[model samples]
Target: MNSDRAAANDVDVDLGRLFGSLRRHWLGMLLFALISAALVFLLAAAATPKFRAETRVLIEQRETVFTRPQGEEAAVPAALDAEAIASQAEIMASAPILTKVARDFDLASLDEFDTSEPSFVEQFLTIIGMKADPIAVTPEEAVLASFREKLEIYRVENARVIVISFSSEDPRLAAAIPNAIADAYLENQRDARQQSNADATEWLEPEIADLRERVREVEERVARYRAESDLLIGQNNTVLATQQLSEISSELSRARAARAAAEADAQAARRALNGGGSLDTLPDVLESGLVERLRERQVDLQAQIADLSTTLLGNHPRIRALQSQLSDLDAQIGSEIRKIITGLETRAETARQREEDLTAEVNRLKAESARADEEQVELRALEREAAAQRELLESYLTRYREASARRDRDLLPVDARIFSRAIVPQEAYFPKVLPLTIAAFVAALLVGAIVLLLRELFSGRAMRPAYAHGETEAPSAASAKTGTAKPAAASPELPPAPRPLDMEPAAQVPTTPAGLTALDIEKAADRLVANGVTRALFISPEGDEAAAAAVLVAREIADTGLRVLLLDLTSTGAASRPMLETSSYAGITNILAAEAQFADIIHADLYSDCHVIPIGTADPARALSGIDRLPLIMNSLTTAYEIVLVECGVTDAAGIERLADDNTQIFVSLIDPEDEAIEETAEALKEEGFGSPVLVSPVGHEPETVPPGRTVA
Candidate 1:
């Protein structure tokens, strides 16, 4: 077995072959690329270079404290969002603004903006009825159309800035147009604001006049209503009648309190007299100066009487005189106390009289206050109406004044301003000659290489036989039976095999001299199809060269219109390379390693209808970790395909057992029937209870060359 053959079979891309092909034609490819670049350079050089210039406008609240409306100066203006900026961009490109810019530049007279005649391509398309003819339009429309074509307006991403770009053959015009558009847009904004202000003032004029008249009328109505109802306002803004009633009620309360005091004093004096209590004990009597003096005299008289009685008998002159004086004093004091009692009664009567008068007056005032309250309700309603009118009139006046001031000063500001003006470009943005030429050259080279690859593929020189590496000459039937052979002379073509005398069917396996059955590629495929075998395992013990038998058998079965899949289980995809034309497909190993799925690994054979899974790029060691899944994967493949062919290269009976099932048919693929490995692998399969393995030979049926147009006999 040649290890190099495994490596050769495993390669997906032959870089050496690719480089060699390029090396053989590098001069021609380079020359073609250079010619393409030269053509692009010349075209770029001769082309009318158009210069592009852009003007940037910043959308923001441009109003300052002095210029802004009253009360707006302190407001934090919301920043323009992206949509607002985009709207501004649209406005900048509006027809009116563009028209102004065009007129300002007299763009209609400029040759750049003249589009009266159709282009050659357009005329050709129209003539062939591929495109409709353009409708007739005025020169202004034509010029506008041309102007619009060269204009590009967009808001800068994630920003509130708008960019206005224009292109022209004349760099100065290109620079001038965008600036003019920005200026026109600003002027338009100012004009719009001015118009709005003028409309506001015009509307407010009549409104203010009407409100003033209404305020005057309402005020007059309030005054008239107040006078008619006699609802005169007093101190503290209360109605006069209500105030008078309140004052009277307070005076009446005071009068009733004084009357009550007087009555109480008189009653207390009467009670003292009736109870025979001392007159001095009475508060009214004690408060009298006359009673106090009388009491003092009475006390002096009693002392005198007491002194006389101590010196003389009863009815003595001194005692008698003192007693008489004391009696006289008591009479006078009683008389005075009685007089005081009369005065208290008289005061009580006067107080009672006053209380009655106050109560009557209070009753009269209550009636007046109720009437006043009723009148005041209507009065208050009138005043409220007048007040509201006055307030509205004031607001209107203030707004009118502000609008007047603004109109006179022309203080309105546009929301957007030009932050950056367009400048005449030093270099043309179009016709970037050097870069375009280099790109053209690179593209041409790539295209040329692809064309060369296709040519090499169609000519069949890049393909080689799957078993070409380390191939040994197959021995004749007699030599194979004896297990000893000399190299046979090379023949132009393989001779036909002699038919068996019994004329055995193509589906029957022929018995070898050793009593072992062997089938050529076609006979093996026929036997599989006849038996309805869903799984066929090929053990390539003679190494990579013998694996060609598996590829040939799969192709033969596939040619019978059966859905066949060839699974390459070899260390290298020796068997898969001939069928798939590439070994770099993900397969059982990748599926086992969980690196790829069944869909990713399975690929259609390049030269036949058979599907194949290559040995894969995954590590074999990693794949073995999940080797237990091989039986499951085989079961899945068998369900999807009519026949599933597995090429197990140089694997033992234990390896075979892992992939084998009851329906599995084992074939020992052989390039040399006499090879010792074939016999050993067969014996091993038998020992493993896999039954006798059928020998499949590609000896006479192998293609001279593979992939492009090789076929089996």
Candidate 2:
């Protein structure tokens, strides 16, 4: 912090010295300043001015807070600070605010949105190097979020009065935005309140009634399923299902009888065919009781055989005798069984009747179960359809009632009145003319003052004096009486210069070191070289690089026939650098600084003409900022050759003026074509003299005459 103060003090001293320089050479500074002021004023006039328009607004709190949904909070809110509210008003003009405006204005649809297709406005913005970006929105927010950025709302100092303003190319648009913003905000509030009411009605009664019907219908369906399936109130139906068991038992008895009869028939036939004494026929095969009796007898015989076998085997003496007796008994039993079957037809008939009855009973039970299932399905279908119709009727009735109730209570809940409508803008809110102009002027002035001050301090010169050097010294009394000039409006900045008595004057002084004198080709070249012109970038303002070109030609003579290089830098693709002479390490400034050898960058011509470099594609603004590379390039190039010719066809004051420094010898300049071309150029030369520079005229093409009518055209 102390260092800063000291630096500030040093700056003050430097400023003092600068003022002293200006005091001694006030004539030069004044002349330059006058010319500058005139040029600025003329530019201000000639320039397609941005006329501004503004609309003002006042935002008052609404009667009630707006809610988006029932039982929820307000969707729209108003801030308390009056000035901040004004800012909100200003936001009405921002992109987030104006996206709707843009949609209203068809801004996005403009050809500018398409890089290949440009509209008039889009093309204009492109030429001016400007673009618009999309705005961001916040969560749960439905309007312009960056309202403050666009809207300029301000409360008069410590007061409730708010000023809402905006800017646009069209004054009508600027005026409209503020009113639109306010209207939008109010409309938003009204919508929220209305939506809340509607939502409340929608959620409150109808939804619950519909849910009740849904639950009732779904519940009834479940209840009917249990009843139809005979699953009464959590009771199992498995006990009633047991009737199926008796039916299966009856069928089993019939099957057993049929199997027994087939075996008895087979035994009888075998006995009849094997024995010499044969039965007349296989008798009463249909009589199943006879077959069953044979099976029983066989069972008993097997049991008796088992008892005998337990005692002795047939192969054994005792067992053999028993086995012979059993064989004879078996042969006789087949014939006996056949005779029993013929005589016992009634038993066989009884057995057949029993089997038939059991079969009939089983079949009847199955048919009854099928009929019951069909009846149950029909009952369930009828019950389900009835429930659906009842529910539908209930829902329609409920909706009708609620809607009728809402109609009965119909009322406008929120009051929305237009506090103000969009009005024609009276002033531009952005690029604020008064404030911006002042700011710009201050900035330009500060830069000018700093530059002037620095030059004065380092060069040790006076600004403007009451007496000239050629004039005889004035008597002390007369000199005192001459008095200082009114101090030139006492600059808003810069400290006062100390009297000559305060500090020792420099040992020597320059004649007109402050600015340019008469201009010529060589003089301009020298100025450019002094300004550190190594690799020149020529941009012709009036589509001609004549003056800068002449300077280049002069530099060529100094090159002594070495392979010199020139590079034309312009959008027109016109190669003007061939007119210059220069020894170069590299034609491209960047390559030269990076120590690129001349042979690499310099292309020798077949005609032995000086090598000319062509301008590569680059954004002009970005390329110009690399100015520090110039010195390094100059140092490298000048050593390889006699001279480095630089021709810069600068037209803008910012460009030429930016080149002003102690290193340069002079500033060669050209004039615009006009009726008073010579006079204007001469006057401009006088102003340049303040900078201690050289101004150049046309090269081989001297001043041309044009009739008065043609001049302005």
- In order of listing, the candidates' clash counts read 0, 45
- Write model 1 residue lDDT over 216-270, tens digit each, in one string: 9999999999899888899999988788888888888888888889899889999
Report, for every candidate in turn, its global Cα lDDT versus the true structure: 0.77, 0.45
Residue-level lDDT of model 2, residues 455-538, one tens digit each, is 544422222123233432211211122332222223223232211111122332222212335444444445554554433323
Each prediction's TM-score against the native? 0.58, 0.30
- Model 1: per-residue Cα lDDT at residue 236: 100
Model 2: per-residue Cα lDDT at residue 208: 59
